[model samples]
Target: MRVSGGSTGGTPSGGDGRDRSDPQAFKRGRKVGQTVRGRLLAPGPQGLFWVNLAGHKLLAALDHEPSLGRELVFRIERLEPELLLRDITPPPSAVDDPALLLAALADARSRFEAVLHRGPPLFAETGAAGPNAPLAPLAARKRLFDWLASTPEAAGLYGRLRELLRLARAFLPVQAGRPVYLPWAFPGLDASEGLVTRSGRTFTLRLFGRLAEAGRVSGIFSLSMNRASYRLSLERPEAGEGLVAALTSVRLGHRELAPVCVHLGPLAPAESGGLFAPLIAGAARPFTGLRLRV
Candidate 1:
């Protein structure tokens, strides 16, 4: 059976499947109160430039998972375009009806809007002070969506979303608005780097792979940086399966083949209880605590 993220289980053979376990895979999962890092590597310069484009949400994700510190870095490389194409599965209906393609585009746009309109963590209904808040996870997610939608360059983003959906459909089913994750299905990157902390102890992580990227020199570079920074954060020993699921759920897109490298270091956890302190202080207040229903 296909795994939840959409690939057949047990890792892909011949470089066409996911790496079920990292080359450095250990028997243990990360522990609470430990620091973690994750990095993604894209084949070209584009990946590197854009890796932290989602910094707003990334920081929030790290905050939610305290085990993850805020330090992330992206190292990128250049590669050939054809090699990148070799990573993704062919779309079952890419050449179907033009109308259908347009409809899919429309669907993708709408989903993007929902994510955009949600705004930032400070505006979330379940903000840090809210009963359902986990250090404002919802709000942070909102900011990420907004940032992507609000970029000044419309044509570029259009191409990006189109490519992302096409790739998403190839590897997994796209529910009009659900997040999808595409592993190294795209060919471009050779490695992703990050820091791993177990029981408060830290270790550096380097992951190699074949990832896809846009053929354009600019696009390749942008993607490289983005992937490197993004994936490296996952290296933390405390990173859990849920966060992994959420990340892999992001839409994957087409790009040129290129080399991608991620560098993560100087990783550190936020001050202890830094995120929780606000909630604690709010609770200590006489009226604010009373007004908020536990």
Candidate 2:
């Protein structure tokens, strides 16, 4: 296997014991939160560059232009199946101490105190647009951070605070006339094939697959639903079961809107001929979700 770095001096397997040069393959070994020190390469299109992070040509998209060839430290932020890092060298003290990182988050928390709320747009409702109100969890975490700061346990609160910030960002309120981007799905355990989006009372679900993406029919399943009884069927794709998940539930400013459940039977692909079919459609079958009123 071809591994890139000054020299790790060992064969790099693609984790299931296969030696391949796939960038995504070598990238999976590293986890978010781990720090890497590497040199930046020249910029690529759309503000992406290649940096040698922890002995690999890690891909990064930094806000500012980094010196072409300077050794720098970065903290892994999100694993886009690749690597997204942030400059941790601003305060070299934070390179090793999570407490310093927590301090940095605290500083950012102060600025994010007026972004989102769990329900309707508060600013529009009250016409009070200021930095006084923050997202619910963000504010809660900030207060918890202050309380923790006074205790001896303050030393180990970085992870908790970081995650709270991530969730807040992930579920950031989808504003009117804006597309709702779902939370990041697990590498293999998640599928967007049969996902549904609801705006007001109208539901739009994408269907059918592009014939060019998947060569032939893989499998087919049938599903039918109603108020009294329901039936489901599944025809796993060539890629595997490829079932869908609703774990990343979203709220669209309604009192009765809530996620029904997680994992469900696979949704068969629907391809009755279309130009906008998904590359790898679900089988000859399909999938769905339920909205409950209490």
- Each candidate's root-mean-square deviation in Å? 27.1, 21.8
Instruction: For each candidate, give its TM-score against the true structure.
Output: 0.19, 0.25
Give me the runs in candidate 2 sitting further than 4 Å from their true place.
Answer: 1-22, 80-82, 91-294
The true-structure Cα RMSD of candidate 1 reads 27.1
CA lDDT of each prediction against the hidden true structure: 0.26, 0.34
Q: Compared with the true structure, what per-residue lDDT tens digits does model 2 show for residues 1-294?
A: 112222222222222232222356445677655555776654433345555555655444566666667666655555663444556443433333344443554454333322222222322223321223221123333444454334322212333334333322322233311221111111111111222345555543332222121222211112122111112223433422222221122222222122332223444444333211222122122122565579
Cα deviation at 35, candidate 1, in Å, is 24
Number of colliding residue pairs in each model: 59, 8
